[model samples]
Target: MSSRTQHSIIDLVSLEKEKINRLFSTADQLALNPFIPSKGFGKTGALLFFEASTRTRMSFETACAQIGVHPMLLDGKSGSSLEKGETLEDTVLNVAAMKPAFVVIRSGDDLDFNDITTKLQMPVINAGWGKKGHPTQALLDAYTIRKHLGKIEGQKVLIVGDARHSRVAASHVELAAKLNYEVAFCGPEGFLPERFDVKVFKNFSEGLAWATVAMALRVQLERHVTKYSLANYRKNFGFTVENLKGLSDKALIMHPGPINQGTEMDTEVLQKDSRCRVLDQVSNGVLIRQAILLEVLGGL
Candidate 1:
């Protein structure tokens, strides 16, 4: 019923508990030696990103190259056929005809990949889908947290900021639930999700006290329909220098970048805070993606 058992990862909820652990194991091994000896010598992967990206796109391309898989990247903005008003299906058909081993796609329309399994001949990994989810990001995030905290289960993770529109937040909430990790949300009232069941905190101090991992999400300004005030958000909900200094010794600071520097967190927190693992998250992204590509392309 869910895409979890399928070759592509469209939803983290579809991933069984055992699969998550296995993936983490594979990622751990891959992280130790990211530049591998060509597990996918003859394979090719097509990466179609319809939205703006820096980390996901580069990390996926790097993963393909390092794993010995040729990566064919398509940016939807430029000379791509989508500019000529070509249907997404037609574009996908053209790409599929090239006979790639798999496809990693991120579309602005969150529902574009709903029927992806039947539309393409090869496996399709949902790189990202609008407000719905970013399964790969969530997977890498889980792997990163496991690496830092020694385990995922039973860990209290406080996901703060713009939770309503953040696909990363959506993915992590689901993934954490599946892995037995406790998750909570903290954000401005309008920015929080209505369907999430976890405890919602109005105070950052309370959130920090309740969490071992404090994951600050970027404000989705691109998706917000109303005017957002950075100054107001920072004063009420952001991770300030004061907050960082007061954090528990065992607490770890995390953020899914590109950070709003002074908005979601003070710039100094990134520089002086020793517990921030934003860069580690970036590094783990490539390894987790490599593991995903290998899993689909028959090279592990």
Candidate 2:
């Protein structure tokens, strides 16, 4: 792919519905045949995570491996020039110098990737960018919803908890109109965003009853300055079996994990509820990421 056409997967809102549909179609193919022949043999990709991650990091690496692409991971925990105060842009430029076919970045701070992308010769994928957006997560989530509910349009998605600091929620809200799904926020006033055009539910029960999917979000304690009581949050907003009673029979439970057993949701709810599609979301993440890698790397 030419540098101009090798677009970065940074913002879902910038992508046309046709392009998003193409990604979903590609994910579907990978889901049907996970062992499909590698199309990216001998290519190398960079995984630069300035923030902590589990599913996004591992799944992208797995996707790269499946496509016969070598993944070089640079995490914040590990020693790097970043620890020596090297700027993220400089680090990315250094990686670009190595001629990696693509680079996936997850940063704690919201960054304007346009500047970096303009300087680079390779495709860039934003894994997560602070509370601004996580387009790949939104793509995988839309894929998961489609797989389970059989379609994306006309479904209601209730994003519960910590919307103020959730990139996942931000991305979902941005993509919701494009995908033709109704999305609303349900959380405490402090956790909710300062401004949103969509519906906001102060009462969790009302939101649950109205939604086709209930996606729980972790309270980012690490990101918060004000202390919060876990017990209070759980009693008011947690997805316990009793609280889940308000949920529609057909409604699916989701979490962009790691799930806080007693805080965001009950352990029983996550483990025993057949309606919970958390694992499916995790499983589908790999396929969606594979599709993304292939698309960005021009392997598909």
The lDDT leader among the candidates is 2
For model 1, residues 1-300, the per-residue Cα lDDT tens digits are: 433227778788877777777778888888788776655776888998888789999999998998888989997658887888887767877888898888888886634686866777777888889889999998888888888889888888899998888888889888987998888899888888987777898888888888988989898887778878989988877888777555677878998799998999888888778888889999999988888887776556
Q: Which 10 successive residues of model 2 have the least lDDT summed?
A: 1-10
Residue 17, candidate 1: how far off, in angstroms? 1.7
lDDT of each: 0.83, 0.87
lDDT of 1: 0.83
Model 1 residue 25 CA deviation (Å) reads 0.9
Cα lDDT for residue 234, candidate 1: 86
**How well is each residue in 1-300 modelled by candidate 2, as lDDT tens digits?**
455335688778777788789889988899888656655778899999988889999999999888889999998846999778888888989988999888898896645676677778888889999778999888888899999889989999999999999889989988997999998999887899885788899999889989999999998887678878999899989999989999988889999988889999999999999899999999999998998888776647
Q: CA RMSD for every model? A: 2.0, 1.6
